[model samples]
Target: MSFIRIGFPSLQQFCVNALVAVSLLVGGVAHAEGGPATAQDGERVIKLAAAADKDPLAVMSSAEGRWFQKWADDVSDYQFGPDKGVFWFHNGVAKGDLMRVLRFHHTVTTAAFQWQKKIKDPRLNPADDDAKTLAGVEGLLRAYEVLVAKNPENRVAKIDDLIAIRNKGGLADFVKAMPPMPSR
Candidate 1:
């Protein structure tokens, strides 16, 4: 869909498309089956979110000013869903199943990134700014925890790294990268 296109070439076109796209995207809501978490979906959600960030207008986080709260809600929805054991690509998924994960995660991460940007906009920011960003980072950490549990291998997503990028504190505070993983 045109709404899925991130980094549109022109700003004017982007703004117009974003306005129309947001409504269309949210118009439909697929009820969650509350099935078990799958490793494949976990990995896919983070990946899609990252890709969507390239163009802010493509998702709710960028277009919707109050996106962080919505993202917090999303985290809860997935976090508390019926505890089905995890699965990676090893199992299977329906067509476009991954797309839903992508849409959801991308919107969430984009919202967090935007908030991180807002509070840290100025180099000499206030302590409150760091606090706000950290709060957002914490939510992401929890979300990632559940995702990583699905398959630690997917930890390569280095989600903590994204949060660290926003923190930009000394390396001491930067989230560590995943340790070397063994080949399957």
Candidate 2:
């Protein structure tokens, strides 16, 4: 019997590391209730989040916005094929960023459950070694839920927090940290 050794790092580990880095960068008490400025920043935050949420291929195809589009394409490249495992890992990081945006949206503006539901997509459900990674995403969701429930004004803060995090460190480090695939 031939054993297939998958030397790659599990998605959960990648999520943990990515989340830890995010937490370190955006230090603050996970407040249940956000401050009042959440509403004012809601629109700006949403636009940024929406931009980030664009389809990777569409972003890559944009001729006029090549620089920004390339960034999205690079992210998509990590999520498919032999790189799938790495995709799951960075999914955790993306989830963390998305959670921050969602919290900002819910807290500062009207309560909208759409973003929350999207994050809970069954596709993200963890399995086997993926359980821990899924849990990390869940943790981010829980934080957003609490923020929304408490402040309903954290929308802007969350957006600002996410932007800062992304600028400080793009997703590249997380992508590089993933375990490499075995040579055929």
Candidate 3:
């Protein structure tokens, strides 16, 4: 076999092309409701992203968006990160709602992007992100409470269970009984 050496210019061009292809592939990596993002939903987000002063929450009304939020709540073990240190997709999946759904949309797509990009430049600072994280938890709680309070059909059981757990000992006890996050 003969060995062929590629010049620096050729190798650099190859690298650039490879990165573009990988980016396109990663664009479809996000999932919703146990399935991948629908093609129409993807197109809508692309359009919204290009629009000036567009509301990201508008995407939450999309088909994939609604499903993803529910999926985030349903799947306690759902996460995106490396083995040791990484971004937690739904660190507290217990609380959820329309607002939380929109927030999760922002987290997984616009803010975090793909897994590789999210890991490189995570939105939350591991060292000093406690306040923001706590704020987010509180926000989810409020959203969930409001959703449950409005006589939402599907949310009553979840809220009731949470209340029951809280009544038992508190959120602390409830969380202590939660299964550990699955390995990435």
Which candidate wins on TM-score? 3
TM-score of each: 0.26, 0.19, 0.30
Greater TM-score among 2 and 3 belongs to 3
| Each model's Cα RMSD | 18.3, 20.9, 18.7
Instruction: Report lDDT (CA) for all predictions.
Output: 0.36, 0.32, 0.37
How many clashes does each candidate structure show, in the order listed? 4, 8, 0
Per-residue lDDT of model 2, residues 25-98, tens digit only = 24322212322312222233233233323221121123312322232223221111223232433444334433
Clashing residue pairs, backbone N/CA/C < 3 A, model 1: 36-84, 39-87, 40-88, 49-106
lDDT of 3 at 130: 32
Q: Name the better of 1 and 3 by lDDT.
A: 3
List of clashing residue pairs for candidate 3: none
Native-vs-model 1 lDDT? 0.36
In candidate 1, what are the lDDT values of residues 1-184, reduced to their tens digit?
3232222256775676565445533543322344432334344334334434343323334433233334334442232110011112112321132333333443355334434344223124434333433433343444444444443533533444554655676422331221212334
Instruction: Predict model 3's lDDT versus the native.
Output: 0.37
